[model samples]
Target: MGIRLPFMVLHAKQILKSTSQNVHNRNKYNVPKGHVAVYVGELQKKRFVVPISYLNHPSFLDLLNHTQEEFGFNHSMGALTILCKEDAFITLTSQLSAS
Candidate 1:
């Protein structure tokens, strides 16, 4: 059996908060420039519009560095990569698990 880490939930919450704040701040400044906006669904659910340009933004870099220090190098790298390539990673993981 695989051992699950207890701090996973806490780490997840921290990451979510960090990412959400990054998105929020980006929207505040970038929206006026027509660089970013929120994705609102018919049901009123909202998702952040994260552009590739935001990857090098100061706030994003700060969050990335903070997350790396908190989560350690490898885990943080994997998490970031997954976020960058979500659909492909999900498909690969699902295929591997089905075998």
Candidate 2:
């Protein structure tokens, strides 16, 4: 019983470590403190990090609504993507920054 307890403890530790490491790796991009990375552009796609606050903005919500309709929340890129012109995205983010 004593030997089994130690083995189980070691196995649980390994599982916890692996789980945390995977989470760290998965969140390495497209997510940061108070920001979200969104893939933008029509042809040549580019990534942009915007404040999470922008998510509350109507303009940003419009983009998200469009993304939902176009991609249906399951993007092949495995990340949230905004299907729009890069310039339009820039313009929207800039507006949020000004406020």
Candidate 3:
């Protein structure tokens, strides 16, 4: 019975470590399956996970076009960053949702 103490302790530690990793990974990309993550905001970039369907929206496509025309195809910044005010982005998405 005394010999099982160390094994139980090690098992507990492994569980804790694995749980921590899972949490970190989940938060690292809150974007769910079938959705895409986009970075927006001007002064401070913020990440937003949006549906792939947004690509078909003309207004959204226009933004992508402008970004391409200005920044070129290579964002190289890890995530696609949309240059715009946070408030404006919120309004646009809200309107999109309404439509």
Best by the TM-score measure: 2
- TM-scores vs. true structure, each candidate: 0.28, 0.66, 0.64
**Local error of candidate 2 at residue 63 (angstroms):** 1.3
In candidate 3, the residue pairs with backbone N, CA or C atoms under 3 Å apart (3 or more residues apart, or in different chains) clash, namely none
- CA-lDDT, candidates in order: 0.38, 0.62, 0.60
Model 3 residue runs over 4 Å out of place are 1-27
What's the ranking of the predictions by lDDT, best on top? 2, 3, 1
lDDT of 2 by residue, 1-99 (tens): 334333433432343344345665456652466665567877777977777677657777767666655655445544456778898889888888998
lDDT at 32, model 3: 68
Best by lDDT: 2
- Worst ten-residue run, lDDT, model 1? 76-85
What's the true lDDT of residue 24 in model 2?
57
Better of 1 and 2 by TM-score: 2
Candidate 1 — which pairs collide? none
What TM-score does candidate 2 reach? 0.66
Tens digit per residue, CA lDDT, model 1, 1-99:
012232333444454445446765556434343223323222332444344444344444444444445544344221232222334334433553454
Alpha carbon lDDT at 54, candidate 1: 43
Off by over 4 Å in 1: 1-49, 76-99
Error of 3 at 1 (Å): 75
Clashes of 3: 0
